[model samples]
Target: LDGRTVLVTGGAGFIGSHLVDALCEGCDVRVLDDLSTGRRDHVHPEATLFEGDLCDEGVLDAATEDVDVVFHEAANASVARSVAAPRASHRTNATGTLAVLEAARRADARVVAASSTAIYGDPTTVPVTESEPTTPLSPYGVEKLAADHYVRLYADLYGLDTVALRYFNVYGPRQACTDYSSVITTFLEQACSGQPITVEGDGDQRRDFVHVRDVVSANLLAATTDRVGEAYNVGTGDSVSVAELAALVVELTGARSDVVSVDPRPGDITVSRADISKARAELGYEPSVSLREGLTQLVVGD
Candidate 1:
């Protein structure tokens, strides 16, 4: 990616910032983020940061101009938040993505999208594959599904080089530990602060918690890989129950916090794991950091 110009949408946010940190090292990087959830400080100083909404035509124009690649990470990522507000999510996740595709088309740049495993909803099969049926049970899932289609549609219609990555439960440092954040972030926050680690439902719900760094690697790979018009599932190909994850966080943080059971909220999935065979074979992607290692680093770093 050296000497190539790149655009990272939402490059001030958790996942996007990580991409910026890597891309800015070799590429002339430009970032477009509204800062609704992203922080200006998170963006690398070397990259050009454009603060504006994706709905603005000028902002999207500036972002994609002369770009070699477009990494579309900006989205309303929370399922619960999407449930509370569907239209807004649709506008951003679906419409915003379409606008980005059009911008990339004009720039003649390859596109790499940060999609989600949520499109799988409650998969009937464990270790869901890319071939699995997309049964989005929530508004967020539906929005992502719609966006995923746009990526494929643009690629087929306009010969746009594109790859969509369906990421599993990604967590790491810099992730917000709020109610809308990932469960790992929330659990770690509670454990560190001595707050009761609330377990929704029976704490039996499983997730394939992939590290943010792994996700970053996959995005970069997708950007440069010759594989176009394809969407690969990004995950560790492992599953851990929420109870086990909470216990691990408690152990790592060494906080005097107790795990408590609670009722499950809406938009909850029973289990999730990814079959990353395609990514490994095609992208040479490997999960280097184990859950324990990643959690330890995140907890001890702060």
Candidate 2:
């Protein structure tokens, strides 16, 4: 990554902030974010921050200037939010992605898109692979799948190198502890504050919880690797039920809280895990942190 100028869209968001920090360790990094959901404080001082939306052509051009790689991480992340506001999600996740791709193409920068496991929809298989059929159930999922396809199309038709990383449940420190945020972050915040943990649905719904650190590593690898025009699953390849996750959060934080089950939301999948063989073989990516260890580090903080 040395001497590389990398542009990170949504660089002030949870995963994006971590990615910015990681990129700054060796590369000259620039960040572009609308700050609609991203916090200004999350932006690293080392990064040249452009406070604007990806859909803004001037903003995109400024951010991509002299950039060698682009990491597209901006999106409406919540399925529920997307359900309530499908148009908004499509504008940002789908259209915003096209704008980013155009900027990257203009700059002749390699692109690494932040895709999602939601693209797999309700997977019929235990461990979801990249080759599996993409049957996105929710607007958010469909938007991401479409963006991913655009990435591949651009790579093939326009000669732009692109890679899409289908991230599982990425969670860790700096994750927003808000209503419309990752489950792990939400649970951790509640448990740390000694609040009741709310589990939507039967609590049997499972997810592959990959740490933000590992996800960041995967993003960095994809940026420079030879794996273009392909998608890879970035996860720990392990599944844990929501019930089990809540229990673990309580245990880890030593918080007193009763788990409360609520009605399942729309587009919620019963279970999701990942097959990381493609990432390991192609990008040389492997998760080094266990869930327990990652959770502890997230709670304790460095």
Candidate 3:
């Protein structure tokens, strides 16, 4: 990434900010964010910040100008929020991606866009692959599916160098504990605060949690890999039940919070894990951080 001008949309957000930090030493980085879920303080000191929405043509144009790569990370990432306001989510997640692709196309920049495992919905298989049916259960999943398709379309139709990374449950530092935040963050917060760890629907649902550091590594690889016009699942390829996760969190934090069950939320997948063999073989992507190690860092602020 040296001697490159890279634009990271949503660079003020959790995953994007980490990517920007990694690129700042070798590339001229530009960030475009609306500061909605992301923060101004999260922007790296060396990177230029462009505060705006992704759909704004002027902002997109300015950010992608002379850029070698565009990391499209901005999105309405909450399934519940998308369920409630699908039209708004579509405008941001789906339409926003198209806008970014267009801007990157004009600049002749390679685009690495963020995708989600939600597109698989409730898969019958344990470890879902890229070829799995996109049976999205919610508006969020559908929006991401649309974005993923658009990325491939741009690559095929316009000959744009593009790749879509289908991220699993990504958790790490700087991840806010919001209503839409990851379950790992929520569990950690609850344990630390002496509040009962809430589990939805008996907590049997399983998910593969990948650390943000590994996710960043995958993005970096996607930026330069010769493999284009395709999607790859980025995950540890290992999963654990939510109940087991809560137990582990309790043990890690040494919190006396009781584990309690709650009503199941709609559009929640019962199980999800990634089949990352394609990424491993083609992109040389490997997840180095374990769940315990990543969770420990988050708990202790390492």
Candidate 4:
């Protein structure tokens, strides 16, 4: 990242903040965020923060100016929230992405987008790969799929360098504990507070949890590497059920809390795991953090 001008959209968010920290080593970093879900405190001191919406063309222009690379992480990230508010989610996740791509194209910048495993919907297979057909069940998933397609189209038609990373259950420090945040964060917080962890459904649903640090590494690799017009699954390639995750959180936090089973939530996937061979082979990206180690850090703050 040395001597590079990097623009990180949603840089005040959890994963984006981590990415900003990683890129601040001899790199000029700038952040553009609406702060709807992102906090101002999460914005790194080294980064120039632009308080604006991504949908605005003027805001996009200001942020993309002189940027060598763009990390597009801004999005409405909840499945339930998207289901409840489809139009708002589409505007932010789908339309905002198009705006970002246009800005990147105008600036001739290499772009790395934050896609989700939700684009795969409920995977019938064990380990989902980049080649799997997208069958989005939720509006959030549908919007991301559209965003990924737009990224590929921009890469091919407009000759813009774009790479999309389909992240699977990213969790770590600096993650919010709110309803809009990741499930892991919410569970960890509850467990730490000596509260019973709520498991939506039978607790048999699985997810491939990747540490935010690992996800940041993948983004950095994609930004520097020559791989363009492609999408890679950034994950640990290890599936763990929600029951297992709750148990781990309880162990990590030393919180003696019983797991309570609840009714299943809408638009919830039964299982999700990633096959990260493409990321490993192409970008030399590999998840180095274990769930135990990452969860410990989240609980103990090392």
Poorly placed runs, candidate 3 (over 4 Å): 179-181
Please give the TM-score that candidate 3 achieves against the real structure. Answer: 0.98
Query: What tens-digit string does per-residue lDDT give for candidate 1 at 187-261?
Result: 877887789999998988888989999999999889888888989999999999999998999888888899999
lDDT of each: 0.90, 0.90, 0.94, 0.90
In angstroms, how far off is 97's CA in candidate 2?
A: 0.8
RMSD of each: 1.1, 1.3, 0.9, 1.2
lDDT of 3 by residue, 1-302 (tens): 89899999999999999999999989999999999999999999999999999999998999899999999999988887898899999999999999999999999999999999988889977799999988898898999999999999999999999999999999999987764338999999999999999999979888899999999999999999999999999999999899999999999999999999999877677888999999999999999999999999998999
Which candidate do you rate higher for TM-score, 3 or 4? 3
Q: Which candidate is the best by lDDT?
A: 3
Give a tens-digit lDDT track for model 2, residues 1-302. Answer: 89899999989998999999889888899999988889889988999989998889998998898899999998888787888899999999999999999999999999999999989989988799898898999898999999999999999999899999999988888787654238888888788877899999889988899999999999989988876899999999998999999999999888998889988876678989999999999999999999899988977885
Q: How would you order the candidates by TM-score, starting with the best?
A: 3, 1, 4, 2
| Pairwise lDDT winner, candidates 1 and 4 | 4
State in Å the error of residue 268, model 1: 1.6
Output the number of the TM-score-best candidate. Answer: 3
The TM-score between candidate 4 and the true structure equals 0.97
Q: Which regions in candidate 1 have their CA more than 4 angstroms from the true location?
A: 179-181
**Better candidate by lDDT, 3 or 4:** 3
